[model samples]
Target: MRADAKKNREQVLAAAGIAISEQGVDVSLRDVSRRAGVGLATLLRHYPTREALLEALLHTSFAELTAKAGELETSSSPEEALVSWLRDCTAWTTQYQGVTELMAAAIEDVESALHASCVALRAAGARLLTRAQAAGAARADIDGTDLFALVAALAWVGDQPSLESRADHLFDVVVSAILTCAPVLGDRRPTEEVSS
Candidate 1:
């Protein structure tokens, strides 16, 4: 792609993210073009259809998330990395409820960009879960599929308008449940435990 075209595409995706968050996935292309400060024709040139635009947005978000997880692999502790990644994941999901809906649509259709993201997310989650388990700080029985489902459910919970105030606490509970051998209640860190 030309440099200008790539920049325009990036702008459109960024604008679409905000528009979708503020309005919804059903937000019109004209609105997205306005938000992007681009002509509708240019926006259409980048993403010919609403589904195409949505798929690009989802793909971008998922790629960023996967990259973050990969970078976190070098963290001092797998447990901390996992918790941090989960928090990031929650924020990403909550930030774009439209993406969640798009994903669901793709799953039902089974031939959308969301389907590709599902595969990628599962692979990334498996890597994280495996690392956490290897560190002896996460449940071995919990598979990537289970974690994916959990994240999806958490995203839905986070999307609730009424639950907005309690989102952090809700996510904390999830983290607590997933963290094995974590200092519980009033217990102090084990004397020989490696610090995170």
Candidate 2:
């Protein structure tokens, strides 16, 4: 891409991020172009579609989250790692008004532009859940799909004005429900003693 084209694309994405935060995934493409101070033709030339734009916007964040899950897996306790990742996922999702809906749909649609990124993200969360389950920190019954769904549900709460205030508390509630027992500090417990 030419320097100017790259610059225009970046501007569009930044403006889209702002517009989406304010108005959501359904925000008008024209509004995004207007905000970016670019012509609609330029924005379309770069992204072509809402999903394409979203795919570009969400790709980096999704990669960071997946990487974070990996880092947490190594640096934190099984329970702590899972909770932290879940919280991060939920909080990040709340930044985009209707992203949870897109994510949920994208994960199921193999042909969708966002499918690959969503699947990778889901796999990352699943790894954390599996690790926690093996350590007797989380319930064995729930799988990665369940974990991803919980994140979407939790994020949806944060998006709603009425429920936004309760989002943090609800997050804790969901975490507790997912975990086999409350988190322990200091030395990790033997899986046998954890007693899910």
lDDT of each: 0.78, 0.91
Backbone clash pairs for candidate 2 read none
In candidate 2, how many Å is residue 116 off?
A: 0.4
What would the TM-score be for candidate 2 when compared with the true structure?
Answer: 0.92
- Cα lDDT of model 1 by residue, 1-196, tens digit: 8999999999999999999888878899999999999999999988999888988888877888888888888864788777777778767877776566566556556667567776776677678889999889998889887777678778888788776665666666777788787533333232343459
Model 2 has an lDDT value of 0.91
Task: Candidate 1: list runs displaced more than 4 Å.
Answer: 1-7, 104-110, 183-196
How much is 158 displaced in model 2, in angstroms? 0.6
Q: Estimated TM-score per prediction?
A: 0.79, 0.92
Model 2: residue 166 alpha-carbon error in angstroms: 1.1
How far does residue 130 in candidate 2 sit from its true spot (Å)?
Answer: 0.2
Candidate 2 lDDT, 1-196, residue by residue in tens: 8999999999999999999999999999999999999999999999999999999999999999999999999999999999999989999999999999999999999999999999999999999999999998999899999999999999999898876766776777788799999653333222233248
Give stretches of model 2 more than 4 Å off. 184-196
